[model samples]
Target: MLEKKRVQQLDIPSREGYDAIFNSNFLEDVPAALAQWGSSRVLLVSSKTLAAQHGDRIAALQSALGSHRLANTKLGVGSHSPYADVRDIARRVQRLRADCVISVGGCSYSDACKAACLLAANLAPDFTEEDMEALVDERRGIADARPEDGTPLRPRACRLVAVPTSLSAGEWNALSSATNARTGKKQHFGGWEGGGQPDLILLDPELAAATSPERLWLSSGVRCVDHCVELMCNPESAEGRCEGLHGHAERGLRCMLGGLTEYKAAKTRARGAGEKQQQQQGTQEEKEEAGDKERQLLLEGVSECQYGSREALTGLLIWRVPMGPSHAIGHQLGAVANVMHGVRLLATPSPSPHSRALISFKTRPVSNLTLPPLQITSCVMLAPVLRWQAANLSNPHYKTAQAKTLAIFNETLGWREASAADAVERFVRSLGLPTTLRDVGVVSDEEVRRIADKTMTDVWGGGKRQMEFDDVMEVLNSVRG
Candidate 1:
């Protein structure tokens, strides 16, 4: 925690110079910008939720767009993040022939608008699935591996303006993330040529003013934790946290705790009678302090949690410690656990990867994690799973089912391996994750070792650097501990 100059500063597009700053539910800024541009046909873009709550405001924005209001589309229902859905949205935009697309709402809605801009600007290629899938995978994780030759959709890019509701930071980034349904992986576009970056951005707290304490809390935690985790995993990154490097990790941790406090306070206020929007009546310095606090927490603790917590900012250019074997295992568990996607990470006692402060969470929130929708047919899993599935592919009986479930179980509780040695299962029982490899279906310590040996090398990315076979056996042995 000693280096100094490495800091991941949030990019502020307001510095890039925009003609107008459209506040939330921007029915207000529409008229002035349109009058200045002397353009007709101001198309309104929104989502189903947004169309319902703020449709009148949007209509007002449309009217303000002046006489030439050609057409607009509200996109939701489909995962706008998926490339196929984005393309569909793009086709709709093309048919509408919008001059400009104003994205309203969170990252998902904004992303759809960005995709549409590409198609309209002729910065994209044909809507082939393979081409789209190839593009999405290249942008999934923490790197820039885009091709120089580009691809089919390179020609149809467009200039865009984004209005973000959450703190995913897409407003400042030049790239957009979409999922490739074919591969079930997130894809990145822009950061080059036509889709490189947005030409303008407007951050109106009022946009976020619509957020709920629960969602705000979740999104806040997600963003702050993501920043913290990314900073820890990539201490050497240009825009990374500074623990050994500086006090960045500490600052980030404070920010996290700070945000938690803010949320709790806001929650209390919201419950009492105050509106959901954080009181904006405070001084600029106060707001800035809150923002910094949010940014700091993001820079610290986020790395300790797994990838799921950071899902809100999925495709944005944030540093993320790719979810390791534990997270993958958790995903498998989440596929069946009664908790939501990221909550298991909180419950699991992850190894301390951070070089900073540790703040205890106030409450153990109830998670809706469950065992459905998680068709763990071909995921990277702990080793016994490899052994069992191969050994008994046809058995849908409880024994096999339990064995398969064990892989997700042991990993969640952080058992070295599910064993009968020390009643380690007792401890996990305290936390509630499954206790034995046998609880799920793992048969022996040998099987545990085999699984750990495998989990550390699963291709989806993470590996157990120290949790080797013997380590896995320890967990299995710990079933008694």
Candidate 2:
């Protein structure tokens, strides 16, 4: 359970290159933060869902910005940030002459804003698909863009401010990703020399509580868990330069696991109480009081999760360590299968003891006959990949990697006797999240092959172990169910 405390601002390490303010009130804090940044003429970007749900809050922000300062507003950015949508956002930025961009939703919105900024700053008005693709493929920065006359482009002036409503933590990084419209493949964009990252991040627990879906909030926290675990076990982490990340990863692991567990438990209790109250035909006032308490509990959990995610990403952002197969394959799975980046489909009424037994055996395939069709977060793939690494004793880094995994289990989670992979899978199951691809609707062998093939091209695909196509296939197949 989260310890009771007054709301407090936390400091981010200087190396991360931005400022983050954690509070429960965005209506007051967001305008104040923007004021400090001197951002007039702001372009607000959000999703259709958020715009509908938070119309009052959106209006308040617009009022705070004032009519002349509010340059434009764009809504309905699709998931995975489609390239056309990004280009459209860029066009709006250039045409409206906005001085700043504010992303008011999840990581997808932030990614679109960042990518649009890069495109608007570097590329010409008539830049082709090939030109954009080349920029993403090479991960080039503004420094690489030179005029035919040998002049360098000026550093971009437009800044990004993120108001993330989930725990995806993409706002913390300089890099961003968008999907190719034609091929349905997600492409990364950024590497801007002077800009293209969020200059300010606002962590409003109220916004998260109000806007984020329950499954999204919990599973994204697990994504942070993926970040912590993979970084701790990354081969480069054993080296002197990367050793600093271990401490941060450990702290992140502890905070995420503890906070998520508490949050889920609290949510369960609140749900039960609500059901009981409904049965009793409780008064409207009583129900409202219960709802308020529930919201406070959720806010507490969200605050911890925000801190945990920050810690998880800090070292990786500073060191630029690439994550392993899970992230690589997850990217493709999201683009190909239309999987959400962070979501877990809970099996109704829970699994039977026999089903649990089947799930326990990592190598055995479980029949999906009795289960309902459900979607899951891509980070659920982490456990099986960890097991693959642990079992591949022939690999030089396996021993240290396994040791790090064991340490996380022992030191962070306080579990004993279980293998690292099993512990992770069990924890995910405890949260009622699926740990297999079959659970998320990727059942066929051919589908697995396609995802594995695409995984190789991901920036983090080979990583420190230098994983090959067969290696990637093996990892995916293990979790194929």
* Cα-based TM-score, every candidate: 0.51, 0.84
Which 10-residue window in model 1 sums to the lowest lDDT?
371-380
N/CA/C clash count, model 2: 0
Candidate 1 vs. true structure, TM-score: 0.51
Global Cα RMSD, each model: 13.4, 5.5
Model 2, span 1-481: residue lDDT tens: 3332322122324324566777636677667766887878789997667678668778888888787678898876777787887888888888877788888887788888888887888787666666667654332212234435544444456877788887777787767888776665777765523255677778887778777766667767778888887787777776787757878888888788877877787788887987788678767998888878786777777788888888887666767676667777777777766563333344644342212423221222344322211224444588778777777647566567666666666675566736677677767776766667766667678777777776767776543345788887888877666
Residue range with the least summed lDDT across 10 consecutive positions in model 2: 354-363
**Tens digit of per-residue lDDT, candidate 1, span 3-117:** 1121112223322333224332345554544455554544455655655665665566555665555455564523326566677667665666555666755556666566556
Winning model by TM-score: 2
